[model samples]
Target: MLSTEDLALLEAIRETGSLSRAVAHLGKAPSTVSYAARQLEERFDALLFDRRRYRLQLTPAGELLVNEAARLMQDVARLTQRVRQVANGWESRLWIVTDELLEFETLIPVIDEFDALQSGVPLRITQEVLIGVWEALREGRADLVIGATNEPPAIANLRWMQLGEMQWVFAVSPRHPLAKAKGPITRAMVAQHRAIVVADSSRVTEGSTYGVAGGQTVLAVPSMRAKILAQCNALGVGWLPRHRVGLATRLVEGTDRFI
Candidate 1:
C-alpha cells in the first residue's frame, strides 16, 4: 500500500542522514520533508527514524519496509509492462503446429531469432501429418501452422501464403524388390507391395493419405520419421520427401511413370 512518493521520501531521508540534506536530495523544502517524516511515523505508529544518533538513520522496522518496498516496486513495474504489451496486441502465448513432413530441427534457427525479441510470449510447437496441419488451425488448436500440405480448406478469417514447394521421391530399402525394379514401375507393381504412410492426426475431419496405390497394403505410422525408418527396414515402400530419402533409402528411378 506504500506509495512511490513515500518510498522516495524514505530513501532520500535514509541516504542523506539529516533533515536539511534530505530536503536538498529530494528537491523539497526542509519544512515539507520534516512534516512528511513525522506523517510517516504517525501513519505506521512506529518511530521509523533514529534521530537520537548524530547521523540520522532508519530503525530496523524502517529498513525492512524499504527493502520489501523495493521488491513490490519491481513487481508493479513488470505488471505494468505486461499490461502494455497486451494492449499493443502481443499474444500471451503462441501455439505453432507443423506438418510431420517438415523436420522440427529446421525451425531451431527461426526460434532463436524470435527469442532475441524478448517478447515474453511463450511458444509451444507440435506436429501433425497431412490435413491434420490445417485442421489444427481450423479447430482453434493452433495459432499458426507451418509446412501444411495441399490447398488449405475453407476456414473463416483464415490468411495464408505459399511458403515453398516440396519435391517427393519414391523410395525403398536397397533390399526391397522395387530397389532393382525396371524403369517406369507401374501402379500395379507398387500395389503388390505395402505402402508406409504417416497417419493424419485430425480428430474431427475424415483425414487424408498420399502416394498409396489402389488395393495396396499400408503401414500407417504416427510420423514421417517412422515412415522413413519403415522403408529403411524394408517394411514397406512409398513416396518420401526428396530431402529426407538420403543414402539409407534408394530412390526409385523413372517415378514419372506414376506420380
Candidate 2:
C-alpha cells in the first residue's frame, strides 16, 4: 500500500542521513517529509526509522520495504516503457517461422541483438520445412519467414528477400549402393534408392519437397535431424545440409543445388 513517494522518502532518508537533509535533497519542506513519514509508519503500525539515532537509520521493517520497493520500481518502469512503445505503434508481439534447413545457431546472434534493443515486442519462433515457411505467413500464423526455398507460392502481397543461397549435398550411408557408385549418378539411378525427406509443416497448403528424383521412393520424417538419422542408418538416401552431415566419401560433391 506504500506509494512511490513514501518509498522515495525512505530512500532519500537512507541516502542523505537525516530527515532535514532528505527534505533538502528532495526539494520538499522539512515538515512535508516528516508528516509523510509519520503517516506511513502509523498506517503500517511499524517504526520505519530509529528517530533517536544521530544519523538516518532504518528499522528492520523499513529496510525490507526499501529493498522491495526498489524491485517494484524497476517493474513499474519497464511496464511504463512497454505501454508507451505500444501506444507509439510498435508491434506488441511478432511471430516468425524458419525453415528447418536453416542453421538455427546462426539465428541466435540476431536474436540476441533484438533482445538487447528491448523493443517491447515479444518474438515467438517456430520451425517449418520448405513451402511450409511461406504457408505460415500466408495463413497469418507468422509475421516473418526465414530461409524460404523455391519461388514462394503465388500469394498476393508477399514480399521476400534472399538471405543467401543454401547448398545441399547428396548423401547416403556407406552401405547404400549409391555410395559405392563410381561415376556421376543420374536421376534414374537416384530413383532406385529411397529418399529420406523431412515433411513440410504446413496446415493450409499442399506443402512441397525438393531434390527427390522422379518416381523415387521416400521415407518421410518429421525433421532435418530425423532425415540425417535415416540416411546414417541406411534407411534412405537424400541430400542434407553439408555442415550437419560433414564431408565424407559417402557424400557426393558438385551436387550443390541452390535452395
Candidate 3:
C-alpha cells in the first residue's frame, strides 16, 4: 500500500518541479527526499525521474503518478474537511419516529430544549407504530423511536436498547359506572358494563403490553389517536397505553384492571 508520505512526496515534486525545492518545502534535507523517491521507484520497479543536476524532471511513469497523486491529495483534503465539519456539528439533522402520544409530555419537552440549545441540530418527528418505527430506523429513514417492544420480530439488521419500563393503567369514559364504582370492580363486573373499547391503536399507543388484548369486546383501529378518539366518541372501553391517555380518561380504580 502507498503511504501518505509517499503520496505527499510525489505531490510536492510535481508542484515544485525540483527534488531540492520539494525537500526545502518539507524543511527536510534533499537526501531524505531522494531516498524516499528511491524507495518508491524500487517498489514500483520503475524510474520516477529523469534526474539532472540543475533540476528534477518527470519521466512518463513519473508524470502519471504525479497526476494521480494530485487527485489523491484532493480527496484527502475533502476527507479532512468533512471530518472537521462533523466535529463542529455541520451535519446535525436528527430524525425521530415515535408514538404520537409523546407530544403531551417528557419527550416533547426534551426535544424542545434540545432545539433551543441546538437549533442547528434539526429534529424531524414522524408517527410510526413500534415495529414500523424500528423498521424505519433499520431502513435508514429514522434515527430512533421511543416505544415499547415485546417478542420483537426477528430482524438481523435491527438493533435496540431498552431504556426503561413505563407505568401501566386502564381507563374508561367518565360516563361509565366503573368510574364511580366504590370497591373492587371485579372482572365479571367490568364485563357486565359495556366499556368503550378503542378500536384505534393510536389511543392504545403506549410502548407496553402491545398485542395483548384486555377488553372483552375489542375494536381494532389504525393509530393511538384514533383509538382514543373512538373512546371520546363513546366507543368501547379502551385498553390504553397509560402515557397515551388524554386529559379526560377516568383511571379505573382497581387491580386486575389490566391484563
Where in model 1 is the C-alpha error above 4 Å? 1-78, 247-259
**Steric clash pairs (candidate 2):** none
- TM-score per candidate, in order? 0.69, 0.76, 0.45
For model 1, which pairs clash? Answer: none
Kindly give the stretch of ten consecutive residues in candidate 2 with the minimal lDDT sum: 250-259
lDDT, candidates in the order shown: 0.82, 0.80, 0.66
**lDDT measured at residue 251 in model 3 versus the true structure, 0 to 100:** 26
Best by TM-score: 2
Q: Model 2, residue 163: what's the lDDT?
A: 77
Compare candidates 1 and 2 on lDDT and give the better one: 1
**Which candidate has the highest lDDT of all?**
1
| Candidate 3: Cα lDDT at 56 | 90
Tens digits of per-residue lDDT for model 3, 159-257: 777766656566666665677889886777666544443222223244333433455555556666666666655565546666656444432322222
Q: Kindly list the per-residue Cα lDDT of model 2 for residues 1-259, writing each as its tens digit.
A: 8677877877777677788899998999878888998898899898888888778788999888777877777777777888899899877688989888776787999999999997867899998887778888888888888888877887788888777776678888877888789999888888998989999887876677778888888888998877876787779888877777663333434244222
